[model samples]
Target: MIDYLDLALQYGGFTSLDKVYLARKLAGLTDQQKLDFITPPPSVINAYFAEIYQKQGAEEATDYYLTLSQQLSLFPKEPSFAEEKPFVRLNLSGKAFGFAYVDGTGLAQVFAEQDVEVAENLLFEIAQIFPHYVVFEQAGKVWMKGNDFDETILMAEETEFLLTDVSVSDQFVKISGLNQEEVLQAAEKYDGQRYVAWSGRSAILYIKH
Candidate 1:
């Protein structure tokens, strides 16, 4: 229900660099550790409370804020994965990737067992990294859907992404800007869970369900 990218861009005024920095820091820490950096101050909490109750005309505040706080990147995650489902589980035996950001792009936290945050070129570099990776599940695939993140984000808002889960070989995910070698290396990192079919300016991250 929460849009992670929107929170950062709209509420936090997060720059592309800020997002990358957060993702890099997040990839290393445990859940408890993550809370320390991401927890919004009283001002941010007040803004969210106002947005939900005062501005949006919500009847309640406490419960809503609790749920909202858990999903937002500015606030630390206290809830578990009960409601927030990941777009893709981390690849088997995959090592955690360090800081990596493309030009005018966001970060990619390719971690081991933990999710890869966002694949890049999301609403704002990695605009789709909602709460965690739930936004991607709620939105569209960034690379394959369109060349522009705004266009794709609008598309996600307008309609539901209908792509079904299938074999990794049957899928053709595309991440623009990566060369063939880089693409292959990414797939290899996912163990046998993902495969890169072909690449030009775009590479595939066909994840096995």
Candidate 2:
């Protein structure tokens, strides 16, 4: 197995303090979990950097983009099974879900879906092999597989919020059961602690903290 911490320090371009923090956080994870957390698809990394560059500046995004590119370059390229046929079909609660294999790049491509649980289960299974970041859409809301940093924050009346959908990747959170105006009103209460963006019926709240 690779020493992820050493690799991060040598080539990931993280500061010494940041690498130490990451090492501590990743210390308890299983080998497979470590791989999953460290090795996301190049496309996903690019998309993340693009978003950051758009919001932040090139100076702010350069280190992350370079580090991620270096990390991916160290891994051998895997074939995308998505081009072939469906990798597996899952039947849950009288619903059919199709999943296409995208190598072991932590990319979970869902061909079909019924509920959030199904999507979560499929991604979890894929993680065992690819051990990378995964994303899917559920309940008309987009969800990305995240670590503990992305926590579940329950509000009144069964309203739920997810803080940071992609772990330490960003401070964006997902808000369900809230409309644009409602989330905006709630944001005002936060006193600029967060900003709300509309995604269909769901709201993506970017947290300052």
Candidate 3:
């Protein structure tokens, strides 16, 4: 039981004391039962927080809950396709941007540098050539929808940003520095269509269509 708690504490980043208490509580349960409790459902996490809130204070409970949530969210998601193989190198404006590959179902992954404008132009060109191929960009630490490259760049120039996901509807709220709502609004009005988001000052969104 203690060993199971140690494993759970290491795997889930739970506190040693908390895991030990949980392990002791479920001591008579089978190994599978212990495993299930350790890899708790969301409800279990919430319940744990509630218990902590009662024992500790709101601050401690909230902190623990957030930490648990962050750790859980870090669990890797199933990949959309098998490991990608680079089929070709992409060059934009005479500069080496990145590599391109056709994944499962003709979906393409474009691993590229953080040049938003160049990426947008190259993606547009790629789209014209491979209309059926869905293009995605792996830039820095963010996975982006291919079309949002330019919009993300413009947004970054105005304020701090976090590359949360590949969604275009995601807002680039003004966190600090000059609010570039006007600039972003103007860019949004442009004839071309693309989605974009930023991570701090770095552009992370890119798409080919």
Candidate 4:
């Protein structure tokens, strides 16, 4: 396996102290080896940098990913902690482009397509992959795959409310738990597109700003 500690220090743009702390945390590697790893030839360093940049688009993704440990605490664990841990980091590579980490909830994937035609086609393809999906409108409308349609869409608001029944307007559930400020902020940040899924649960919520 690749040495993640060395990689973080070398390419994560950490300060000198950060590098020292990272070096200390690394297992088994000698100081000389770590130095050599950092002091590679110019061409090799540039290639390494290029590869790192290619794999990770920005710091945000890395920061978000590292927060998995903290996020785990928000959820109720299974009978065993061993079984509960590694849920979020349990990424099946190439499964999806984006994923959400919910507390008691499950994981959710978000696919944002600028092209309507492409998105529509992808939506159909996604439905075929899963039996049923949740549907909601972001800045643009979206269709989910799953049986819990009411749970997902009912959470959608004209501005940001849930729709209990697609055919009827009377039945609805206002999304609770999240504070009003957070909801407003999400609406602004997502520009009206926020979908959520909880782990081990079929329920999916599609939030539209």
Candidate 5:
């Protein structure tokens, strides 16, 4: 196994925490994915600054990568502690996903693609990969999968407005345990985009600008 941590350090563009997360993420990759992540030599990245100094293992190469990371500003990432943790990070076809418990939810499922397996086969295979979160596409909608899920809770008449379904629109945002004004004020900074952050059980959603 390649020492991802040392590789990140040698790259020298990440903070201590970011490197740890980067290493963890890289460790899960198939070998091909790791190969795809290699940074091209600076000359290939930008010939504007291209010089003979762009060769690999050269000090200039290190400086160029460092400059690239700084230009990208892909650092200082801090994890958010939240009430609902994500089941898995999906590397889907340009789609990102995360979900919250709508209540009475149970079990965790993980799914990456829907090309081969049908629903019955997926359900059977899920147990083989026991104790891992599953995600799958159903009715053209993506959802987390779990065998123990009791969907009855979804029909509860007492459903207090859920940010997910009740209202989700561009400029709409939710900050759990906050009032409408606070959530809206936060959205104001977006100049507007649909977003939400979960913490406690309750949250205020802003549906309009």
Candidate 6:
């Protein structure tokens, strides 16, 4: 048994007396037991924190970071489901695209998967195509290719935006700041017809039957 309370006080940013009391509470071992813990090698203490304290301290750690980010938000508005978990698994065609779960404050679980590297790459690609989509690895699998139609459209509009800008050509209306939503919307209009434009990041919307 490690003198965890003392360790916390000494190394965990707590006040001195607080450290002693906390250490006493955590170790529950007698003074002699605490003495053994206090002088134990650094590796032992580190292991204790990694395996035991880490999980125990997760809530506090999470809250601290969350509060910090919230204060920095330019337009700090709580999510609609702030009180609920932040993510939802994306399912399609009765086949699971991938598992998705949100956090306590409705913030999507950005990196909850197990295969972090692959999940990260997938997330990057999907973000360009759909900003709201998140990816994570779990048990050697990546979940969610991207956000669904509604989330994609909404996020695209929210970020990339859709606007009608001045067109150099007198006969055409230039759609500038076209995000995925605008693209999809314009795409929908030309379902049975063809239209074309000449200037944009990608091809100007050329809709065809």
Per-prediction TM-score = 0.26, 0.24, 0.24, 0.24, 0.20, 0.21
C-alpha-based local distance difference test score of model 3? 0.40
- Candidate 2 global lDDT: 0.43
- Report lDDT (CA) for all predictions: 0.34, 0.43, 0.40, 0.36, 0.35, 0.34
Tens digit of lDDT per residue, candidate 2, span 70-166? 4534222322323232133334445554443333333334444434454333433333322223344444433233222344442333333332222
Task: Mark the 10 consecutive residues where model 6 has the least summed lDDT.
Answer: 148-157
lDDT of 1 by residue, 129-197 (tens): 222221122232222121222212221111122332112223233322234344444434343333222
Regions more than 4 Å wrong, model 5? 38-209
Poorest lDDT segment (10 consecutive residues) of candidate 4: 83-92
Return the clash pairs for model 2, or none.
36-131
Candidate 1: C-alpha lDDT: 0.34
lDDT for 78 in candidate 2 is 28
lDDT by residue (tens digit), candidate 5, 3-112: 54555544433457676577776777776455335333332444422342334422353244334444323222221122122222323334332222222333222334
- Candidate 6's TM-score reads 0.21
**lDDT of model 3 at residue 208?**
25
34-153 per-residue lDDT for model 3 (tens digits): 655666554455566667767875446545533443333322232221212112234555654433212222223444444455444454344433332223334422122223223443
